[model samples]
Target chain A: MIPLIQAAIVAVFLGTWQMLSPALGLQFFFATPLAVFQSLWALMKSGLLFYHAGITSLEAVAGFLLGGTLGMGIGILLGRHQLLAKVLAPFLTAIYSLPKAALAPLFILWFGIGIDMKIFLAGSIVFFLVFLNTFHGVREVSHEQIAILRLMKANERHLLTKVIIPSAIVWVFAGLRLSVPYALIGAILGEIIAANRGLGFLISSAAGRFDTAGTFAALIAIMFLALVLNRAITFAEGRLMPWRAAEEGREVPI
Target chain B: MPGPTAPPSRKSSEALPLIEFRNVGKTFARGALEAVRDVNLSVAPGEFLTLVGPSGCGKSTLLNMTAGLFLPTTGEVRYAGAVVADINVRVGYMTQVDHLLPWRTLAGNIAVPLEIAGRPKREIAAEVERLMTLVGLTGFGASYPSQLSGGMRKRAALARLFAYDPETLLMDEPFAALDAQMRLVLQVELKRLCRLLGKTVLFVTHDVDEAVALGDRCIVFTSRPGRVRQAITVDLPGDRDLRVLRYDPAYLAQCGALWRLLTPPVEPAVAPQGRRE
Candidate 1:
């Protein structure tokens, strides 16, 4: 029902856009949704859309994996060890708050329009998001639970694997959910600034040629990919964390 | 009226006291304030001992030391003749809150200690099953801790403790969160299980009746910067049920004595320390 209502609202907005673009004598610079869809159809038929999408997807996936792994590892370490957390917290926080887009030019300068620059740019953005959330998650685990683990004579490794990791998993997943979009944004932004191939390049090139329909087509494709990735995250979260789902179910009675 | 039919054995003599706290003093310097004063207690083999006192009395702190979660500032806590430096795997500590890992299923939570101990797969499975049955959690093993009721979660916590086969059990208000009926049921089950396994049990509670009902020997302590007020040995009928013991006059007297020891003394009203009105 909610989706249906949303779709109706979107349709109305698109119809208004279609009517206003030509009525206001706006140049082809502002494409209607129909025109965007038509151009997307053309791109799809030419098979270039999938190729660019594949490149973008690879960068996004690689960035997400690298960022997620590094974030979780460092987060858990900082969370578990008080000395390291205390020592590195200020530095990490400073770096985390910096504008990620500003760093892209530097990355591009160093890596020179290659996949490494895009991957690193996206990875860095996603890394901090996951790291901070995971660190908080691990730190927030109850002292009482730690006491229990200790009393059970759990060694350091067992404590980390069984108690610490499982305890932080919900937070990790939360970080993952928030980081996925950042990953896509980073990749697209990196591509826009420097790349010759990717959805970002496609959009930039279309804009340069005043091909509003092609730009809009790229935008729609990005949105579709983002939605798909978000759903995948939700599905994975449901599978990995049935307990959280059960808790939510209990909160609101049917 | 009769003892067990099994013949007595020399092995009983070798059963050492599971836990012994001698002149144990734990003082938390809240800048300068002390939290627990001099205290001494011993938990005999197969005995149920309870530390009961008012809020802020450091009972939980005392239990933490016993579990080797914390070290006493000025005394020793020994388990099976060895001084406790770290947590003893031979001891099981149940906290006031169940603290069952929310992410794990009941069985998974119960299997935690076994998992930590690196038990074999077959052993972990069998032990979890046995503990579930023992705690009346047979069918609820697959359910997450959040899915269970408060009483059920407490039971699962107990099962988790038992699964580790710890010779000594340290409980810090393990049933304090449960409803009255649930508390009673668990208390009875705990007592029965302790006797059956001959495990040394040191349980802490603020409730007078619960302490009296469960403890073979009850140790009462004073309020903050706590000290032992009295140690009373309860010699109730060996086979008497907990339900029946509630009505027994001796039990009531013990409860009254414990209540008297726990109540704070009334002080005479006087002028303010630094101001005069």
Candidate 2:
């Protein structure tokens, strides 16, 4: 109730002051909420929103899946075998520290200004996020628990399925949830850098023509897509880890 | 009960010692610190052996060595006459803290070992339900570990250990975390289960009474680089009830003997604060 009331207060302020009232003679630059929504409606009616949004979503989701799986595999593999982690630690650190998105141009050079570029871009970003998280997850898995399973005469298959994977799922989901925004960022940014389609292109191209309303509309669409994806991951996480409810239920000090 | 020494002669007819630590010595910090040293012990088949030691005595370390979680630095640990080269699955381990997989319900926790063994689904379910009832968790099968009390969690852990019906049990203070009443209750239940299943057990704890009550033979350990101070063969009957055993003269005698060995008069004083030379 408090949040709803707070949101209403902000919405009323924005609607009245930013739209209803006259601006300080800056209409060309600052797109009002009303103008952004108007442009959004226009794009939706023209069916452009569906096409661009669809392309971005496809690139983001596919990249997310590909990167997430690759990251998890590498993470767990390295995590389970510390020797591999030691050998690759410096390399991973250096790569991870670099601005991965800066490589978008290089990827464009290799993969061209097509969906492939955007997909690879998004995959690279999401891969590191999930890899680091899964690695930490595997590390945090209790040695005592592993010892217990081993004493039960569990084979390697049992260790992975019964102990390793289940233990790492929580961290994997955390990485997945955080990757939603990064996935969109990667896809949209890649699109803006070179592509002729996607929300990123829509915003960048519109800005070139000084279409502030169109830019705002594209930005809002990106936010909406991110929210939807994040909600999806959250829903899946809840379904997968009902046990976490106990830990979450305990009151945390603010 | 046959005397602990009589086991050597009876080995011809009975099963051999299920586990043996051959002059085991474990050093940590690349040999900088010794946790347990010069420890040689054996547990016969279906026998209950309790290890009593002071805090940080590395009694648990010895158990880990036998489980093949850690290799002895200077000697070898053997299970069923074979050197433990990897994780030994012939034993079921119960830690001092009940590591009930929080995600799983009580029944699901019990089903873990069986499920890992690739038992039939129906069999796992039946066995889980049966073990839950056996551990006095009959109707609490669906409840998660967090929902249960500490003692109940311990029982659930015990059931999970028993799920696979392993021939040997390597327990590291499994009841130490419980309350006094719960500990006694669990001791009785555990004794009954172990006897019925004919499982060999290597139980570790710091409590002398608990050691005497549950063990056929009790090995007392000195602290820090733990070595055997004495090995007292307990005289209590195998099937003795926890209540009666608590007051048994022989039980007290054995417990007292171990206590004397562990905490002799003129006990070592607290270490110097390193202030004055």
Q: Which residue segments of model 2 deviate by more than 4 Å? A: A12-23, A86-112, A250-254, B1-16, B30-32, B179-185, B241-243, B246-249, B252-277
Consecutive 10-residue window with the lowest summed lDDT within model 2 chain B: B1-10
TM-score of chain B of 2: 0.86
Best by DockQ: 1
Per-residue C-alpha lDDT of model 1 across residues A134-224, encoded as one tens digit per residue? 9999998887788788778877887787778888999999999999889998899999998899999999999998899999999988888
lDDT of 1 by residue, B1-277 (tens): 1323222111323445567778888877642656677787766677778888767878888778877777988888888789988777677888778989888889999988898888998999998998888767789888887777878898888888877767778898888777877677777787776677666778888788888888777887766677777788866643448877878999999899777655543233532233232
- CAPRI quality band, candidate 1: medium
* TM-scores of the models, in the order given: 0.87, 0.87
Cα miss at A53, model 1 (Å)? 1.5
RMSD of each: 4.9, 4.7
**Local distance difference test, candidate 1:** 0.82
Q: Encode model 2's per-residue lDDT on A1-254: one tens digit a residue.
A: 99999999989987775764345666688777788889999999999998999999999998999899999999999998999999999999999998978998899889999998899899999999999999999999988888888777777788788778889999999899889988998999998889899999999999999999899899989989998898889888889888788667755644
Clashing residue pairs for model 2? none
